[model samples]
Target: MSCHNPAAKIDIPKEAKKIVLAGNPNVGKSVFFNYLTGLYVDVSNFPGTTIDISSGKLNKDVVMDTPGVYGVSSFNDEEKVARDIILYADIILNVVDAVHLERDLFLTQQIIDMGKPVVVALNMMDDVQRNGLKIDIELLSKKLGVEIIPTTAIKNEGLDKIKDALYRAKPGNRIEEVKEIIDKIINKVDTESEALLLAEEDENIIDRHNIKDFNGQREYIYKLRRYRVDEIVDSTVFEVNQNASFKTKLSRMMLKPLTGIPILFVTLYIMYQAIGVFMAQTVVGITEEVIMGKYYYNFIMNILGSLLKDSSLIGQLLIGEFGLITMVPIYILGLLLPLVVGFYFFLSILEDSGYLPRIAALVDRALTSLGLNGRAIIPMILGFGCVTMATITTRLLGSKREKFIATMLLGLAIPCSAQLGVIMGLIAPLGLKALIIYCLTIFIVFVLTGTLLNKLMPGESSDLLIDIPPLRLPRLSNVLKKTYVKSIMFLKEATPLFIIGGLLITVLQYTGLLDSIASGLSPFTVGFLKLPPEVSQAFIMGIVRRDFGAAGLNDLASQGLLSGPQLITSLVAITLFVPCIAAIMVIFKERSWQESVLIYVGSFIISFLTAGILAQIIM
Candidate 1:
């Protein structure tokens, strides 16, 4: 069956062409896929493979990406999956790391030998220059008999041409011996790709065809492909200089303890000023107070007031304090958009510059003490952006123990960026003491939780395995595009959930469930935490979302209902509160139900318990 057939489990249109992206690992295939297919793509396990394959529609054509593999064979599941995808592809867009052509070209040559139309993206052109190497692009293209486009994917350069070059892609140079063998077997196989695989005596293909599975030429074919790749690389790539570039020197500085620590601190300070201070303070005031609060609120109210009864259920649903239309837009556009956008922009630039990996390397030893390798820091850092996503990312951990420990810490302590934005806005008015106390408290919890889990968990974590990308100057166009795409996507997905949360809160209020729950929790809220019963409402909404809960406290603070001590207590409690519903669901998906429940109950108990103690200390 064709890959687009129902057996492949994809819904490609009948007339649509299939373009499969093939590359080795860490060659920027994903970035290229996103650019070609857009931000939101459908990801699923490819048939029986455990690994996921992502595909998206581009105009009428269906573009899909395969797992990065060295060659098309059944040596591993990744290779097997890529082999199958390549066999059925109408065209192959092979992403070759320009810096690693010595290795990448092996795959390129093998794919070309399969008699497939191929377009090679000579990716990481900037990294090639920084490494002081040059590629004879024209000669390489000639050697492979394919169109090779040089692309600096992160810089958003040369990508536009790849889309255009798809039309010009054609079969590359095939080895004479392989071609002769393929010509003999081509009659028995469904495609040229299969014929090449059959020529190499691929056991899987041989079985599928039920032909003679005893051909002894596999080793010869692989040996021939390697020799050809080496010949092509020798003639087309040159080392212009061996001297270290500025980026090289900087990467060295960033990996060393003395320099990296200070650098990390400066980066953190800049991030805080941009996202926490400037965005939380100045920009929010205009978006939240001036535009949405003063202008939009008034405009909506005027229209709603003249049209419907303010006291009716429909009025309460539409124009109520917790109304979907009124509260949802205001909270999303006015409050969260600027803060997330600023943070994502900063994060994009940081990630593009290749500093995030260095940060991981710098903190690897410290993480080891917590029963995790340095790679754990990546998800922890990502937790600040979205614990839901960071939860999913814990799959990268080598052991269940590390994932459990990391998930526990993230759920209990790390505040998402939007929540942090609200926290900063609330605490800024109360001075440095409140800020320090919050940070110190959360930090202590994070350390203690990880340490305790380390001691209690049964297994050991895997050693740090990481690939460090070359450091380079971030491109403005790339950063801005990332920021804009990510921010808009966040809002688009979040708006419906926010509306549901607001509507649920409104219904609970009208039906008295909200008040009743508050009443039940009043003893702890009022007596222990020294907070009002209304604070219970924040915790209730927190189960829906961490930021919504923080925004609830923001509502209380604006109404002058919380004193400095009470505000600090509430913020700390909510900060340590259960992660949002999405994160909880993801945690459940990533781990057993027993582990998920433990995290959930543990978070709630610890959040309140910590706040109660802090309430006495500060209140």
Candidate 2:
């Protein structure tokens, strides 16, 4: 919903025509919206729904973008919002994927049957050519009875033609059923759009218009409409070659479990090198130790030191080790920022190249065993970057049971990017054996916990129904834009959390509460976990930020405090600990307070109990 704009809410001129851009998912509507709107666009939450509607101006016409849907119906919030805007549209600028003529044309035909003026942007024609498919544009135009502008949205080809053709858009051919339905219901409804939706048995539309009652013809109408679309596609599209392209062949390899699992590992290994090893070890070493650790620290302290010299208490709060000015920025910018940016950059590429969905499809079987479909992998993968953001992504899952299970797993097992970086660094010196132990332990926990939850939870996971767009080289400009915006959002979210954590720690340290708490946790920390009392301090810090906890352990390791087995045990425990404050807050926001508390307490007990058993054997 976000990351693209510093866009101010724009007001449409009262006299302006509302031009809607509608299409199936991944048909390149956003590209067209960006080109047409230039740098200025508005994303406003549609009334009475959580979905946002984007608007920009094209001359006197107001260009709006709706969620990509097969048809406008009230099945979901996305469809309902799209249905409303589409209903009110003065002209529908339908963007259709040329390669998906039969599938994409169904919605195009739906709009046409509603008697709404619409212009078709027959997009991805370049893909159509590369895939060895041909479409007769003249025949398609004549068949649909609308202007069909073949466009390659990425290359900016035929865009101007689409803009110019808007003025010439008119209603296309209507089927016999639509004409008959309109004749029966036109006097009852205010608009042709409503009549079309009512014919489809749209409950919301029927309620709004106060329809007495009508028999459901939705299934029959859909069957006929699909038949009509297939008819048009049969006449207009042709296969130029019988052979599959190389990309097509590779895509198949990506879907099969045999090749796909290895490909997934290679992708994960690359990500680990880039974000965990390179960004965490190399980039953070320079930024944290050399830049912020020495130069910026000394410079800021020197200038501010003299200013706060008179009040020792004030100086301790502002310039102390846990000071907001000292620790917050250092951690957020110097330590975490590079890792976050790297992770987002990699994620954007997976999304843009269309490989993310393939990963989901490949893992569907494995995830199904965990009471989740392949689609749940999106949030699971995202949980590594930031559990807070991933919690929001859980809304994408179909059922309440799936969302609850996904949220629980994320809170319990997944380590965020910042924490993952630090954890990787800790495990690096422990060698390959320790690394394997760590991976095996976490993997076992993930599987065992998920299986138990599946048995305990009612209802079944929904099947993965996702789009797999033709894989191609991702556009660099698009990828970078996504990375930059998402990184900015990360900084914005992390900044406040770090500041509050630093401030709270400063207060606790000054009041002697931190030491007192550490003393109080001696039974659990020293006796149960068999770690030193100082390790309790890191556990406390881990509550604020998991990476901070791991970094604290790193400091202990640097000082030659923790033995190897103890270090490994502590690492396992901390990695499985309750999520950081940011993630905890998000869990509370996403789930009920009862559920949130249950996850937190459950993770705490599981983390220590599991790690404690390992401590007995290893240490």
Q: What's the lDDT for all of these models?
A: 0.86, 0.85
Q: In model 1, which regions exceed 4 Å deviation?
A: 1-243
**Residue 311, candidate 1: C-alpha displacement in angstroms:** 2.6
Worst 10 residues of 1 by lDDT: 1-10
lDDT of 1 by residue, 1-619 (tens): 4432222666678898899999998889998899999965888877776878899977889899998887888889888888888888888999989987877887888888888899999999988877777789999899889999999999989999999898799999988888887888788768878888887777778778778635647766876877787799899988665665877667767888999999999999899988899999999999989999889999998887789776777888888888876888888999989888988899889888889888998999898888998998888888888888789899998778898999999899999988999999999889988888988988888888888999988977666646677788899999999889878877876788788888888888888998899899999899999998899999898888999899999999999999998999899999999978888988999999999999999999999999999999997
Q: Which regions in candidate 2 have their CA more than 4 angstroms from the true location?
A: 1-69, 74-201, 208-242, 305-312
RMSD of each: 12.3, 9.6
Q: How large an RMSD does model 2 have? A: 9.6
Candidate number with greatest TM-score: 2
Q: 200-301 in candidate 2: lDDT tens per residue?
A: 898887777667768757866786787888899999998665465888668878998889889999999999888878888899999988898889889889
Q: Clashes in candidate 2: how many?
A: 0
Candidate 2: give the clashing pairs: none
lDDT of 1: 0.86
The whole-model C-alpha lDDT of candidate 2 against the native structure comes to: 0.85
TM-score for each candidate, following the candidate numbering = 0.66, 0.70
Give the top-scoring candidate (lDDT).
Answer: 1
Question: What TM-score does structure 2 among the candidates reach?
Answer: 0.70
